[model samples]
Target: MSSTLIPPSCGRAIAVRAGGLVEVVDVEGSQVGDLWAIDVADPRRWLSTSHTRDTLEQLFPRVGQSFVDQRYQPILELVADTSPGLHDMLFPACNPALYAREGSPQHPNCADNFVAAAGQAGVTLPAVPDPVNLFQNSAPDADGRIAVHAAITRPGDRVRLRALRDITLVLTACAVDFWPTNGERCTSLRLDQLDGDGN
Candidate 1:
């Protein structure tokens, strides 16, 4: 197992070897970390939020449990469980259009992070797909309105990933100025590898 700390409002790219585990810790409460997983070799077939959410629904993760994406297969396990609240199943990674819609004139969005990470790994691609928003909550209302709210994760909460293939994990601690106190500005995080025993 290996461990590293990511400072608040920053991003980190991690490469996970085949059969290895990657654990993301939300050291500070209310921090939002945008996450994306890509096969180091293929780079195209990356983490799918729809697939992940379906797996989570099947496993029924409860409070204090961890979700596992085994063999990149359809069935994910709830090795350790945690409570579910306003988890977003359809939200995609931030893109230029999204930024523009949100009234931000920023060129670099979450897609930029993925592209940058891939470039750093010597991979080239025209575009990266949508990514998963970990520790963030966006709920939709009956009239089809999306409401962004504070994160439901508390300090020390974490999400664990078990690699099904040799993959790269790209993450950016979001620093949305509108939500200054969400812990993204100066949050702390710890990453650790899991043993075969799933501990």
Candidate 2:
């Protein structure tokens, strides 16, 4: 296992061998990285933010805490961790409709990206649900509506995912024009296998 840096504006299919570690770094500050993790043996059983958050709140992951799936399987171990304190669990992937709303007159959407990727991989699905927003922030307002705010993440911040089962992880750095207050642009990400000392 070697460390690979995925530059901004590109997508990659990362495989996390059972018990292997996957760490996503936000190389540029305040950018959002959309992530989805699927069971390799059964892609249907992917990572769920609702389930993950529920578990995290209950267990309170500290340094070296393990992220467990709904079935109580350890998906990723948190060898290295950092802020925003929590991740956004409610932002769904941008669909065709969203594209019509936010995309430029000729550009594609996030759903298209997922569909293209899935098609290339030969995995089929009815609909793509909300994915985990790794570095974005959505805070509930006084009236209880969620508001998209500037990212709480800074450069070099990361979340580590360890495989609970054989899994396929799908990720796309958000291409949305309106994001992170400053602006939304491609992010440079690096994925590295944990060293023996766990740095």
Best by TM-score: 2
- Model 2 whole-model lDDT (C-alpha atoms): 0.65
How many residue-pair clashes does candidate 2 contain?
2
Please write out the lDDT profile of model 1 over residues 13-111, one tens digit for every residue. 777777676677788677766776676767656666655556666322443433333234522222342424434446666667876887886744556
TM-score of 1: 0.74
For every model shown, what is its TM-score relative to the native structure? Answer: 0.74, 0.79
Query: Residue 121 CA error for candidate 1 (Å)?
Result: 2.4
Residue 149 of model 1 has an lDDT of 74
The ten-residue window of minimal lDDT in model 2 covers 177-186
